[model samples]
Target: MRRPTHLRLLAACAAVAFACSAFAQQPPIERQMSPEQFKAAGLDKLTPGELVQLNAWLNRTVEEETAKAASEAKRKVVNENRGFITFGSNEPIVGRIAGEFRGFGKGRSYTLENGQVWEQVDEARLAGVRKSNPAVRITPSVMGNVWYLAVEGSNTHAKVRRTK
Candidate 1:
């Protein structure tokens, strides 16, 4: 009985080994060169050394083009974000008030000298009467589209949002 069991285990191990070796697939190449591609490029007739050179050039070209495409894509994202009127986190704006300042008591809107219109979103008000065309700054906080607006030198600020 023991001899028969040992023979069965050996047979199972041999079958597994045979299956693994016979069904093993080739590793994928970084760049594929199919038979049709080889024929199209007339690479099928190239000498071994010349074929090696062609593959090297193709790999380099693919790498450079991939890197260039990635860079352009990143630039496009940044430009698209910049074109919008919205302010991103950490970005700040400084400009003169377009008209006489009334004061933000219960959320008011004001047009800056630069033509940007902003509205206060909170109940924070100014202490003193802001004169005509006072320079103001609106800066984004740690996160979110929420911005804080105040006079150039005043500590008082209000949570505001862009209207136009």
Candidate 2:
């Protein structure tokens, strides 16, 4: 029932995003003209009111572009060479644990083979769990500095915090 509305909202946002990127703006006339050409065209002799309007438009353009750039940069994935994991990013980490996978329990920290450390923060205990070097994945939650760890075969999971 709610899926349709959610999909519609997603489609609308995607359309808006596509339109914004598709409409590449041409350089304003103020920037395209050389100083000599601008002076020759008498644009340099504008009234005070007209000059103010031109400056205002240019300033607004710059501010809007800067804000858009910052917003787009937030969605970028961090490079693997930097730290292999990005804080506050929704990217998932998948690998085997350093030791045997005895399943999730409260107040436990599991070190993955990739040299990342995640400490269980919630009381989710798995029954009948025993494996060696089982694959695991830690996914970031919507909130900052929060994550959930899930083993490869079990539906059980636990809230975890990355210590390293």
Candidate 3:
């Protein structure tokens, strides 16, 4: 005799429950962020008084986002410079360095700490160290006819010609 459809459904649910329980015994993933970091990450763009409000909003957003059953909780921020851009994954203000050029040239590469490498072209070499042993932070600046790229985490800087 064939079993009832409801009984089959009940067995399937039990099997799923058992598998989930078994997986739950593993260690939880660890991730944490500090408030000082949040503030240092361009959060100062907003007024000091507005920080609390912003923090609350971020917290609620994170909570609501994390509770979604079918969502991937990954966040990234990207900033563009004259001919360069940097990317940060879940890290405030600290981003990965990247660049492209119209006339810099070929066969030029910048090497960072741990042997991470990037390429420079044309007049980019005049800007001093293209890449350093340690990855550098970059901020935007202008000086007369030259455009400056200031490294935040270090004292290194690069100057490139302004096409526009």
Candidate 4:
């Protein structure tokens, strides 16, 4: 009985080995050539029109990739530097504000002037004003111990108080 069992196990092992060998004898699935290989294989011998189309396609692909990378980098920068506002007493307010504001009031809190702190506002509400009134200027003014902001325009002269 022990011999018969051993022979059965040996036969099974031999069958498995034969099956594996038979499978290995077949050819593997062919892989597509890389872009370099394709070029080397005379793909570069395309017509002028085809070359133009290829160049345009390549340029568009590069542009899309570049734009995606730039967008991701900008997102990372914004995430790293969030909830903070940079203001200049003499600079234009419109330019001081970022193109698209995100991550505001998400990390830390801080104040701007004497008691004026940063607040989160919807982009849509601010977008129209920022676009239509692009020349608005914000400046810090001190009255005794109180601090105030002033808005100026192109046609308007300086020293005109717009805010208290």
Question: All candidates' lDDT scores?
Answer: 0.64, 0.69, 0.38, 0.37
lDDT by residue (tens digit), candidate 4, 1-164: 33453455456556555654554443311124576876777756877787667656765665566556555654543332222222223332222222323222222222333322333221212122222322233343433212222223333212321121
Q: Estimate TM-scores for all models.
A: 0.47, 0.47, 0.24, 0.29
Q: 48-135, model 2: which lDDT tens digit per residue?
A: 7896788678767865885576455433323221122334556677889998878778888898897777788899998678888999
Ranking by lDDT: 2, 1, 3, 4
Q: Which residue runs does candidate 4 get wrong by more than 4 Å?
A: 1-41, 85-164
Q: Is candidate 2 or candidate 4 better by TM-score?
A: 2
Clashes of 2: 0
lDDT of 2 at 81: 18
Give the TM-score (vs. native) of candidate 3. 0.24
| Segments of candidate 3 deviating more than 4 angstroms | 1-107, 114-117, 126-135, 140-164
lDDT of 1 by residue, 1-164 (tens): 33453465456556555544443432222235677875787767878888777767765665666556555654444332321223353557778888888677756887887566787889997756758888888877775557788886667888877665
Clashes of each: 0, 0, 6, 0
lDDT of 4: 0.37
The candidate 3 region of ten consecutive residues with least summed lDDT is 73-82
lDDT of 3 at 145: 24
Candidate 3, 23-71: lDDT as tens digits = 4443311113365665567664767567667666656655554444212
- Candidates in descending TM-score order: 2, 1, 4, 3
